[model samples]
Target: MAADLVRRLAAEALGTAMLVATVVGSGIMADRLTDDVALALLGNTVPTGAILFVLITILGPVSGAHFNPAVTLVSALQRALPWRAAGLYVVAQVLGGIAGTIVAHLMFDVPALALGAQPRTGMTQWLSESVATFGLLLTILIAARSRPQAVPALVGSYIVAAYWFTASTSFANPAVTLARALTPTFSGIRPDDVPLFIVAQLSGALLAAGFCRWFLAPEQAT
Candidate 1:
């Protein structure tokens, strides 16, 4: 069982690294390919979604495909994930994300471990994160309960839409958010702005988990 857990954690870390690479790498590629911000974002969006679908589909069996600390926390809160396991999951995710950012920088020939300078603070950005994370958790929980098989595609598609809809580009994952802060690129966020974003994300995640608990809990037998 311990060996199994290690393997599962390895899957989480590797899957998360790939996910971040997909997001940051595509954003860099998009920015280089287009002068138009809209076009650049469009370039970034599709690949991120596509890779997420692939990652989740492939890694779901091993780690429940949770690449986000917010998701892990929610799962633990609902007793779906054990507390110790959740801790390991979150640590693996953060470390994996940082490594992924470095890989992205290396691939682009950008300075490795450069801090993002983009100012992403303010109420609008914070609110957007909350909304984005809330929707993400809601999607995961509801989809897992109703149509488990379609989760990967649904999550991927929802992220694509969230990228367009949210002001902060739908950075709904804390691990992803922290990793983005390491790159001074199109997808990067200011390091200073990270705490606010994470706070809002956690709040949103917790609230969404509450709603899911009530909504998905089996009712008393007649």
Candidate 2:
């Protein structure tokens, strides 16, 4: 059991690290290649969605591919994961995400720990985050229940859509939001705004979980 937990933790950390690396790295690459913000966003979006699909497909069995603290929290609330393990998962994800930012910075020959100056705050952004996370959790819950095999694809697709639709570009994940704050790049968010983003995400996730509990309940035989 101990060994299994260790493996799960490692998988979570590694998956989150790779996810953040792709996010930050792609943002940097896109920024360098384009003066057009829309095009740069497109460049960032595709790679992020693609990487999520790949990582979830490859690591799903190992750690359930929960690279987000919000996901982990919802799972724990649903009793799909133990609380202790869920706490550890969040820790692993946050640290791994930060490491990923550093790795991306080094790859692009920038300082590793620059604080983000990009201001990603305001009511619109917060509401967008809540909506983004609500949709994400709902997608995962419904897909996992109805078509377990399609969860990865559905999640990847949802994120792709959310990026274009949401005001905050659908950061929906707390670990990713925190990690992005460490990068002063196209994908970065201001560190000052991280707390509210996280709160909105968690609120959205919890709300989704609550809604699904009733919506997804098994029909009682008459």
Tell me each candidate's TM-score.
0.97, 0.98
lDDT of 2 by residue, 143-211 (tens): 887799998898999999999999999999999999999999999999999999999999999999999
TM-score, prediction 2? 0.98
Query: After superposing candidate 1, which stretches have Cα over 4 Å from the reference?
Result: 218-222
- lDDT string for model 1 (92-136, tens) is 999889989989889999988999988999999999999999999
TM-score, structure 1 vs. true: 0.97
Best by lDDT: 2
- Ten residues in a row with the worst lDDT in model 1? 213-222
User: Could you tell me which 10 consecutive residues in candidate 2 have the lowest summed lDDT?
Assistant: 213-222
lDDT of 1 at 40: 96
Instruction: Show how many residue pairs clash in every candidate, following the order shown.
Output: 0, 0
lDDT (Cα atoms) of all candidates against the true structure: 0.93, 0.95
Q: How accurate is candidate 1 locally (lDDT)?
A: 0.93
